[model samples]
Target: MVNNTDLTICLFPKALSIPSGFVTLGICIGNVFVIVSVYSIRSLRKPCYIILASMALVDVLTGIFGFVAGLLFALHGRFFYFGDTVGWLLHKVMVSTIALSLLHHLLLAGDRYFAIMYPYMYIIKVHNRSVMLTLIATWTIVILGLIVILSPYYSKDVQNVLEYTFMILVSTQMYAFHLRIYCKAKKTAGQVSSSTCQAVQNNRSDFKAARITSIILGAFSICILPSLIHSIVIETQGECGRCRLPFYVCSMLAYANSMLNPIVYGISNKTFSDSYKKIFQKIFQKIIRLC
Candidate 1:
């Protein structure tokens, strides 16, 4: 077993570190784009879109805390800049963000399902004030959970177990939501015939939503499974010195999920795509005028 003192938590070889830093930088930028696009476009000011904006905010924080901070730690090779307390706080923030990100994915899936399955009820139940309250409640729960994780009540082993258990539960809930959405969408499509142009357009929109849901799930599973599996293995077996590299790689992959959502969901949607194009075009024209 590598002693906690001896084990370098964030250090990576030059080859790996450089690439990881680049990936993290890209994630930060992509998440920022999501935040900007959601707020800048007037058409995207609905409940579901507000949820997306909130998700992007979580992702942006994740990129900064999980990836960017880790990169800085790797570069410094120690906690010389921030000291031990900052490092500990960063670790807590990373875990908290990861939990929030997982919950947010499920939240998004549930929001979509509700909007599709109970459109009228959703309108009444999930209004702007309700959405705001829900978000606040979620963050409050997460913060409380973080307090427990940081408290001395749980030993390190217990903490690991709790974290893993939380993740497994979240994963299960997300999958259940995905399956429910699929079945509901299928049933809805079966009822709504594509006989009229409007009906056909509605069907196409549903299909697109399904495709986007699949992409989100696919990206999440790919990025998260590696880390989840690795964590489980580490928990089962005692610490292996050689496991550090793979753990770091898997962690990077998990954080990469933050980047993939904007590309898959935001750019794929027509409204956001058009907004993004206009935003970029204006920025370039301004640059040209400045020059």
Candidate 2:
């Protein structure tokens, strides 16, 4: 007779295990490069960069948490390993960091919208004192949300409510940011240079901002849906459906959101792409010279 744990372990190895393992491991590795790229470059230090840095920090933690637990599950088959009180605390920080990243990225969309469309107004409004105040308020709001999400009895049922609410609000907010940008483009007499005109007329700059914001928003919802459903069902005595397919798909998509930041910058920002390439070449050449 097969034991429950042994049976659980056996089930995954027989199924679509290869792809599941690949995305998890690859994302974890890629996020390290993304983290290094953001912090090493000085020009990336705009306030929106504050949001990006936060995203990178959180994603790195998420990758760590996910891979550690995920790889263990893959190898052991059916084991769900979490430590005691200490593990619990670490988990909270990890969850908070991830949640905070999501919230801050939403703020980043708003930040970029203001910076791009109303550059002068933004500087005046967010001058030294105001910038600090806004950041402080944002920090407080995110911390409070994280606390509520990760507090006691973290079974999947509570997770569903949280996920649903988070998604609905995020989706709504993205549209709001989208609407705001469209309104600005209509109202303003933007620059007419070949480059800056391309940026403003085609709305390239704002669109680039929106691209990151939209992807972060859209991918987050798409990636986490299965996890949300899985958590709730598994926790509450709901459908114990063996839909490894959905979980695996969702997990991979979620992992991509972490590394996708760098890929977006590479495509959208010429300066960032050039700067990063130069920095990496320098580092590589120095290593070769040393050798």
Candidate 3:
């Protein structure tokens, strides 16, 4: 009567402990930094910024609470023991974090669609309450999804698989948007310096955000999907083999979402970029004076 925890024993042999430790640390520290950066901005008080901040916070938790710390349990095997409530909470938080991220992404896509398609007209229409509603709704959606999975009818593994699948599909919508942006940028290449083109890549356009979303969704579909499938199969069959590698890879890709938002995506528009540069320049000058 072996179970999922026993599966960890199976993975311990194949996983590169050294690399996993470093990777997990990298994700935890990097995501923590991004979340902190997002909140430090008084200008980032809008709904969209809140959503991004939440996502980064969860990414940090998922990396530390879900992966890096969870791995310690695996490394210790039967040597480590913890209270039942703590263990339950850990699993619950992990599930919630992953599901919530999916919901936040959907909201982000919706936000972009409105901003680009409507622009000035939309700004006048969206009041503060509307933003609050969107933020509340994102968590509501995640909670509802978790309630479905946490139901007595389904197993934990079932919930995990469904979460991964939902992420894959919803993310595809975002990727399609990014692809459209890429095409538009290509068409206007001569006029766009590489830096200028980069800035507009995810600015406020109907095509802008959707296109950037496409890039991310596309990456998840290709790089993250196979691993998710592997995970589902292993869970359903109660068998373990070469599955851990893909599962680990997919998890990392998902966690990388936080870093991607600030780096890979074109959220750094001219306005934001200029702001970023000015702040950094002042810091650099201060540093030189101190030296």
**What is the full ranking by TM-score, best candidate first?**
1, 2, 3
lDDT for every model?
0.73, 0.58, 0.56
Quality of model 3 by C-alpha lDDT: 0.56
Report RMSD (Å) for each prediction in the order shown.
Answer: 3.6, 5.9, 6.1
What is the lDDT, from 0 to 100, of the residue 218 in candidate 2? 59
Which residue pairs clash within candidate 2? 156-231, 156-232
Instruction: Please give, for residues 1-291, the per-residue lDDT of candidate 1 as tens digits.
Output: 212342234445556657666777877777777778878878677666777788888988876775646556566764212335566667667889888888877787777777666666776788778887888889899999888876755467777777888888888887887788788767667556545676456555655665676688889999999888887787687567333778767877887888888888655798877776787798899999999
User: What is the total number of backbone clashes in candidate 3?
Assistant: 11
Per residue, candidate 3 scores C-alpha lDDT tens digits across 42-122 of 655555556666766666666677463445556554211122334444555666776676666666666665665455666
**Winner of 1 and 3 under lDDT:** 1
lDDT for model 1 comes to: 0.73
Least accurate stretch of 10 residues (summed lDDT) in model 3? Answer: 77-86
Question: Lowest-lDDT window of 10 residues in candidate 1?
Answer: 1-10
TM-score of each: 0.86, 0.68, 0.64
- Candidate 2 ranges with C-alpha deviation above 4 Å: 1-42, 79-98, 116-118, 127-159, 186-237, 286-291
